[model samples]
Target: MNTINSILFIIFFLGIIGTIINRIHLLSLLLCLELLLVSLFINITIWSNSYDTLISLNYSIILLTFSACEASAGLTLLVSLSRTHKTDLLIKLNLLQT
Candidate 1:
């Protein structure tokens, strides 16, 4: 069981890395955030199941809620940028003149 759990952890960690390294698309960034959130949910669920406790479940719920809030805010900002610039590409957002 330990080996199986370790394998899952490694796969999810790889997803986290992929998300971090992928900056070509704004949508990919959102996807990567979701992937990381899924990893957090999976880790907490597995730990809670192994220990036969409810704390991990509660924590996962809270974390998911926070993730939702973050995604909403990020999407709103992205939409605003798209409206002003007419593109979602990160490289094209430089119209802000920063």
Candidate 2:
């Protein structure tokens, strides 16, 4: 059962990497980030089960919250950018004002 869970976890982790590589929608990118967060959370929990320590799980939870905050802030900024310019394309965005 643990092996099965590990395999599933790995698959989802890779899926996030794949989605990022494909440069999908912004929302999809955020979803992939959340998926990665979950994968890490599960990994830390599984490690806690084996190592009998709570530190790893605690760290994972903290990082997950940080990632959530990052996603929210990034998306909010993206929304503001899109509203100002009416576009979400990175190539067209003057993010550096150059």
Candidate 3:
């Protein structure tokens, strides 16, 4: 269980790094975000199981709900942006006035 938790943490860290290094596609960014969220959920579950508590489980449930909403919102935004711009590249989304 400890090993699994460590692996999950590593995966979460890697996801963060990937998100930072990747600035090309919106989809990839969203996927990385989801990966981070999943890692968090897994960690929460593992701790809850280790401690035999309900609080962490409740928090995990809340996190899951928030992640779902985030994913949906991200997808909606991506779809709208793609429809308007016809591209999902992050570099092409320049709305700042210059």
Candidate 4:
């Protein structure tokens, strides 16, 4: 169980790093963000089970709600950006002027 938790932590950490370093596309960034949320949910579940408590479970539920909101917002932004720019590539966005 501990090993599994450790692996999840490493995976989550790597996912965050990958999201930061890889600017391939907006879709990939969203996917990575979802991956991070999933890893967090799993980690929270593992800890909650180990501790035999409901508090962590409640927290996990809240996390899931936030993740859903985050995913929706990201997709909305992606749609708007793609419609305006005709591309999902991060390099094409003009952040300074926008």
Candidate 5:
């Protein structure tokens, strides 16, 4: 259990670093965000293991649903940005363009 916790912590930090260092590309950012969510889901699953099965299952389902929604939204934003700008670089995205 300690090993698993340590591994998850490593993964979470790696995801944070990825998000910070890969700010140039929207795809990589999205992937890194997913990695963060996955690590969090794993941690929640492990933490909930000692509780009621139904409660843990509910938490898992909620997390999964949220992740799915987040991924879909990010993908749509990426597609729209790429279509309009012909690139997925975060630096080129002008969200407040007049």
Candidate 6:
């Protein structure tokens, strides 16, 4: 249990660092967000197992569903932004600029 917790902690922190460092690229940020969500899912699953209850497992499923929706929406936004600006850099995404 301790080892699993440590691994999950490392994964979560790595995702956070990746998100911070890749702020310039939309795709990288999205990938980092996905990584974070995956870590959260794993952590929740471990917790649910420890409790030996079905309720936590159900909640984890809900979390997964929401994460899937978020990923799809993010990808759609990324595709649209890249098509409009020809790049995924955040600096190039200007709504007021012609």
Per-model TM against the reference: 0.81, 0.73, 0.94, 0.90, 0.89, 0.93
Relative to the true structure, candidate 6 reaches a TM of: 0.93
Q: Model 5 over residues 21-94: C-alpha lDDT tens digits?
A: 99999999999999999998888888788564668867877988899899999999999989999999989777
Query: Candidate 3: lDDT of 24?
Result: 97
Clash count list over all predictions: 0, 0, 0, 0, 0, 0
TM-score of 4: 0.90
Tens digits of lDDT, candidate 4, 1-98: 56898899899998899899878799899989998999999899988998899999999999999999999999999999999999999998997895
Off by over 4 Å in 3: none
What is model 6's C-alpha RMSD? 1.4
lDDT of 6 by residue, 1-98 (tens): 59999999999999999999999998899999999999999999999999798899998899899999999999999999989879999987888886
User: Residue by residue across 1-98, what tens digits does model 2's lDDT show?
Assistant: 57957786887768677675746355566667777777776777777778889788788789778878988887997798779878766557656885
Q: Which residue pairs collide in model 1, if any? A: none
Question: Residue 47 in candidate 5 has what lDDT?
Answer: 77
Model 1 over residues 1-98: C-alpha lDDT tens digits? Answer: 68867877787787788777888778778878877787787788888998999988999899889889888988997899788878888876676587
lDDT of 2 at 84: 88
Put down candidate 3 lDDT per residue, 1-98, tens digits, no spaces.
46897799899999999899887999999999999999999899988998899999999999999999999999999999999989999999986844
Estimate every model's Cα lDDT from 0 to 1: 0.82, 0.74, 0.93, 0.92, 0.90, 0.93
C-alpha positional error of residue 1 in candidate 6 after TM-score superposition, expressed in Å? 5.8
Estimate the Cα RMSD of every predicted model relative to the unseen true structure.
2.1, 2.6, 1.4, 1.5, 1.6, 1.4
By summed lDDT, which 10 consecutive residues of candidate 4 come out lowest?
1-10
Instruction: Report lDDT (Cα) of residue 32, candidate 3.
Output: 95
Candidate number that wins on lDDT, 1 or 3: 3
Error of 5 at 8 (Å): 0.5
TM-score of 2: 0.73
